[model samples]
Target: MSIQLIHAMNDLTATHKDLLELSKRKTEALTNNKLDEFQALLLEEQKLIRQLEKQEQKRQEAAEAWKDEQHHPAETLTITEILGRLDVEEQKMAEDAAVALTDTIRELKRQEHLNKALLEESMKFVQLSMELVNPSIQSMNYGTASSDKMSGRSLFDSKA
Candidate 1:
């Protein structure tokens, strides 16, 4: 059971590493403004996320099984707790896997934030360009009260 748990953890770590790589690629796509590539990456990311979810479920089941084997009374078991019951070599393996997974997850989050900022900046640029091309009407209010009626009118007539 401990072996199964360890295997599950390693599998999860591998999947996370894959996801981290994808995130880096996504960042590149966003920076380069490659909409098609970004869309493809998003689809790939969704598939990876689904695989990760399944691996996570398997890990949970393994942990529960290990806990049952150990006769642990708690409703939940932590990796540390599982480590305590493992042999030295197994403990080392689990600890290394956990650390690798944690680091990958942290890096992925940072990359995601960076991508979000880049996307937002891109959107702002597009919006500014659109406004420049077709600006909305605003009140000039430089004339008499009668000019107030023209507040909502466009400066240039499109039908002209």
Candidate 2:
């Protein structure tokens, strides 16, 4: 049982590592405005989330089993509490998994925060450019400008 618990922890750790790598790639894609690449990364991220959810379920089951064997209540337990119920060797495995997952998640969050800021800046720049090109239009009234009204396209559209 403890061995199974260790395996679950290992799986969770591996998933978190994969997510960290994907998050970095996502950051790059967002920063470069690579819409196609960003869409692909989002799909991959969704699959990873599914795997992570499965792993979490396995871990929770393991925790419940350990708690039961120890005669503890059947309440939901934190990872730390579950680790306490594990044997020495299994405890080490759980601890390592916890630490690795935590660190990877932290780094992923930092990169994602940076990517969000970059996206916001890019949107702001696009808005400023639109305002510059069509000073007569306020709040994107396409009919306000003669060129916009005639072409039925944005000022930034090359074909317009």
TM, every model:
0.85, 0.74
What is the model-wide C-alpha lDDT for candidate 2? 0.81
* Candidate 1 residue lDDT tens string, 1-160: 9889888988988998898899899989988889999999999999999999999999999988888889999887888887887899999988988888888889888988988999899999999998888865553335566567887898899998
State the lDDT at 20 in candidate 2: 83
Instruction: Find the number of clashing residue pairs for candidate 1.
Output: 0
Off by over 4 Å in 1: 139-160
Model 1 TM-score?
0.85
lDDT score, candidate 2, position 145: 66
Whole-model Cα lDDT per candidate? 0.88, 0.81
Q: lDDT score of model 1?
A: 0.88
